[model samples]
Target: MQAEAQLAKSAILEVALQLAEKSSWDRIHLFDVAREMGVGLADIHRHFRNKDALAEAWFDLADAALLRLAQTPGWQQVPQKQRLQFAYSAWLDALAGHRRLTREMIGYRLQPEHVHLQVRGVLRISDTVQWIREVAMLPAAGWRREGAETVLTTIFLAVFARWLVDESPGTRKTQVLLGRLLVAADLGARLVAGLSLRSPASLRAFN
Candidate 1:
């Protein structure tokens, strides 16, 4: 009895995702989810306010996955770039099974008429990037912290854009792109900090 009661939001999310896989987010109704779960509509409401909340709940799964990485063995000992890649890959892999459905959910909410949802999307990106930073243990401060967040957000979006259509084994193609982007961002940041790319003798030859 306790186990069944615990299903609540998580169970509702699973059923909705399964239904969505066969059909779509638009076609699935609260009553359908209740019927599928053999519970009443009120039971579903006890967990989720509406169908859209289920999509948010789905993303929460990825967030939870990313957080778990912090507790992984040697997580804190790893270099920043490697930790970033592992953390980001874990977040994406959580949605790998439902990539198409996840994309559809975003599209449904991104309609021009749904300005509120679009705004929420921006917040979601910010929150995810912040979470990734925390998990990777980046210790940047003030302007440096802000700059790091901006670069991380840009890298995340670029990697995510590639990941959406990536069909490579274990998403190796996306990982390759992610590694290249991180290196490029590092080099760009170094150059901006006035670090010379050429050796001192090379500069002397140009002089």
Candidate 2:
């Protein structure tokens, strides 16, 4: 009995996520998820007490997906330019996949418990700066060290928003432009701070 109940609840949550992705979170009724899962409505209620619970689950799911994608192998083995490009492309795919859910999720920011936005945003910015550092083969200097993360975050969000509204082909041009903009910003920050690029010592530390 316990195993069957657990399976039924998992099915409801899975179906709820799918429905939220296809339409909006608001459109994901218990009846809809239950029907899609071939389960009774009570099965969904058994897992999520109400629609809000299901919506919260959907938000969590989206956050997990973004973090996972940002940590993929393809993202790790590249120049900063390529890494940012890959990240942007991955982000676009996620947005396209969850456009409907995101629209409804956006309206829920009035709620105080919605900390996922800030948490995920900060983590992503850190990841972006790490990518830039690895590719540039250098550590940040002066105020750039403090501000590079914020600059990358701002650049990414601006590029992504433009991507969401752009009807351009493949987002290729936008990606290229954004890449140049980010590289320029990083270089400018370093120059203004009078920082010179230092070679990695592990390559030849003990001569």
Candidate 3:
């Protein structure tokens, strides 16, 4: 009985994944997933309460895979810039591998307060950002902190957008551009802050 229950549960999730690949998440329905799974709708409900629950589970899988990648033995040994590149690259690879399904899943915004369902995905992204900062030797306390975080997130989204359509080789150009932009912005902000500290009167001198 337990084995049969587990099989039904797996079928429900599998059908949902297939539906996502074929269409948008908004179009996915529990009834349809059950139909595709060759099981009754009641069987699916026994496993997943609703479409939202399944969406959360799908993202949870993606989040777990990302955390695993981060824990690989050689991952930390890479340079900070390379680390950022790898993080983006892995996301691109995952999206590419599950392009149809991910396209739908990525569109849903999990509520910030929904800690129970969103915790793993939220922590994965947060930790990755923090890891990048630490490896770059970036100071946590500074005027640049906000700006750096903004830029990093922007670069990440931009890379994903490009990967969605880019046919270029290994996204080499895109990766290089993103890396240069981030490094330049970080260094430039730090330099400006340093100068401001040392030459506060320079502004008046210029005026």
Best by TM-score: 1
Mind sharing the TM-score for model 2? Answer: 0.57
By summed lDDT, which 10 consecutive residues of candidate 1 come out lowest? 198-207
Where model 2 places Cα greater than 4 Å from the true spot, the runs are: 1-14, 17-23, 40-77, 107-144, 196-207
Per-prediction backbone clash count: 0, 0, 0
Clash pairs of candidate 2?
none
Residues 1-207, model 3: lDDT tens digits = 999976766567767877767777768788788777777877777878877677656545544454556677776556455655665565556545565555545545455554554665565566655554544434435445666676666676676666555667866766667777667654565465565434543221110
Please give the distance, in angstroms, between residue 28's alpha carbon in candidate 3 and its true position after superposition.
3.2
Model 2 score (lDDT): 0.58
lDDT of every predicted structure (CA atoms): 0.82, 0.58, 0.60
lDDT of 2 by residue, 141-176 (tens): 555555765666677667755664665676666677
Query: RMSD to native for every prediction?
Result: 5.8, 6.5, 8.1
Question: lDDT rank, highest first?
Answer: 1, 3, 2
lDDT of 3 at 161: 61
